[model samples]
Target: MSSYVEGALVEGERIVHAGRISAWALWHLIGLGIILLPAFGIGLVFLIIAYVRYQSTELAVTTKRVIVKHGFIRRQTVEINLSKVESIQVDQGVLGRMLNFGTLIVAGTGTSHAPLAGIADPMAFRKAFIEAQDEGQEGI
Candidate 1:
């Protein structure tokens, strides 16, 4: 792990949180292993680089917002509050459709910076995020 989130907090009895990219990016690694690794060492190096990048990237979700943290030196992290979310969408590809992995895009009510992407189990994530927000609101 990055050791950045050596410890963190999660709330509620049914804390449904967004799934991470580290969960579903194995396909990319597998492709590297099967097709590129031994045949082309340079390609293998790049594949390993990509795997490192993917592993570094994470999707953290809480009741208040969705957080996307990634990048090595830069460590770009984006958090969007539930109140700003106008809509949540899921994008599933062929393998994703079969495996139930997809990207979740959250549209903001006003001036969205960038939509979230490369998430696994996007529908579940969306439901969990909304439910957590609702639960948080209800508890207040």
Candidate 2:
């Protein structure tokens, strides 16, 4: 769990699902790194970038809301309450379908729409969100 998500949690909130960045999303970087590995180790830079990006991003669905944190130094965070989310859309290409990774677009009540790319198992994330939303509604 990332510090941002841990600290952002309110009373009685618990994470129901935690999403991750799939290595398949960094295929280009990994491929370039491998191809350039013999050229004075320049490939290491690409690999490092991929690693940093994968490590820095955090995605989770909680009992109350959906939380996403991106970036290592400069940060970007998105939070949408379960009651406020209007829809969760998943986009997956052929390769993404094969690898089980895709993008998630979360549309909330009002004017908020968050697009989260390079997410692993986007369908699972959407399913989790829906389940959580249903549970929240039941408690109301």
Candidate 3:
């Protein structure tokens, strides 16, 4: 668990699911050979981006809410209460489906939509979230 998510947790809120972007989803390895070139600035930039994204982004679901955190210095975080969530949409291309990585778009009440890309086992994440939501609602 990242410090960001841990610090964001409220009293009695427990994490139900936690996940990170898969390295394979980045596909930066295909361009790794470009680094050998003298003018490899573009390739290096891609590698840096992929590395940063893979390392910094986190997705989690708690008993109270769903949480997503991304970025390094200027961080971006999204938290949506389970009760407010309207839908969790998953998109996977052929490759993504084969590799088990996809994008998850979470739509909450109003105009809020949080899109988490390259997430590993997005289906499982959605399942956990739905289960948590059911459990939370049952308690009410």
Q: How should the candidates be ordered by TM-score, best one leading? A: 2, 3, 1
Model 3, position 131: C-alpha lDDT score: 98
Q: What's the CA RMSD for each of the models?
A: 3.6, 1.3, 2.3
Give lDDT: candidate 1, residue 63: 60
Flag clash pairs in model 1: none
- On the 0 to 100 scale, the lDDT of residue 74 in model 1 is 79
Q: What is the lDDT of residue 56 in candidate 1?
A: 75
Q: List the residue pairs that clash in candidate 2.
A: none
lDDT of 3 by residue, 68-121 (tens): 999988899899999999999999999999999999999999999998888999
Q: Per-residue lDDT for 53-76 in model 1, tens only?
A: 777776666766667777878788
Candidate 3 regions off by >4 Å?
A: 29-45
lDDT of each: 0.67, 0.93, 0.87
> So what's the TM-score on candidate 1?
0.75
Looking at model 3, residue 105 earns an lDDT score of 96
**Which number leads on lDDT?**
2
Worst 10 contiguous positions by lDDT, candidate 2? 1-10
Give the lDDT of residue 67 in candidate 2: 99
25-115: candidate 2 lDDT, tens digit per residue: 9999999999998999999999898899899999999999999999999999999999999999999999999999999999999888999
